[model samples]
Target: MMAFSSVTEPLRAANRVGGKEPYSWHLISADGEPVSSSSGFALLPDFAITSSPELSHVFVVASIGVRPDRNAPRAIRVEASSRSIPHRPR
Candidate 1:
């Protein structure tokens, strides 16, 4: 997604310029499969939440065009939300 890339580009560029990789990131989706953005471009996630490594920060990017299935229960989301993960201060 454009917003996702825009948010991370500066961090990545800084790593490049500094040559020390001070920042790194991962793209994650509800499942491990690739997800499409509002513009229909798909991005493959590095890992699913179930299998992700320890994280320092979490950022959520959403699109107004996408809507959840009202009839179905979101089991994975519910389970992920129940976890008590702590975030590192910036």
Candidate 2:
């Protein structure tokens, strides 16, 4: 939860203080459902992996430690990759 806040708050603050939405964000999830945090807070995602738009940045914020053997996350990545969304420019 803290990590997600740490990353998002800055962008939020920038938009607030700058009086312009220089940074925009969307929460994309594998199922387009609410995701629970490490502390158990649920965050409703804006789009599903398959329904997300072409994103300028994608930040995977996982507060919990995930074992490499976990296949669910990997499956989500695979589903997301099937989209024709172009990669963000470097």
- RMSD per model, one decimal: 4.6, 3.9
TM-score of 1: 0.73
Candidate 1: where is the Cα deviation over 4 Å? 69-83, 86-90
lDDT per residue for candidate 1 within 2-35, as digits (tens), equals 7887879999999999989989999876667887
The C-alpha lDDT values of all candidates are 0.73, 0.75
Q: What local lDDT does model 1 show for residue 16?
A: 91
lDDT of 2 by residue, 1-90 (tens): 898888899999999999999898888776687877767788999997777787766787776673343645675657656764354555
The regions of model 2 sitting more than 4 angstroms off are: 66-90
- In candidate 1, residue 67 scores what lDDT? 68
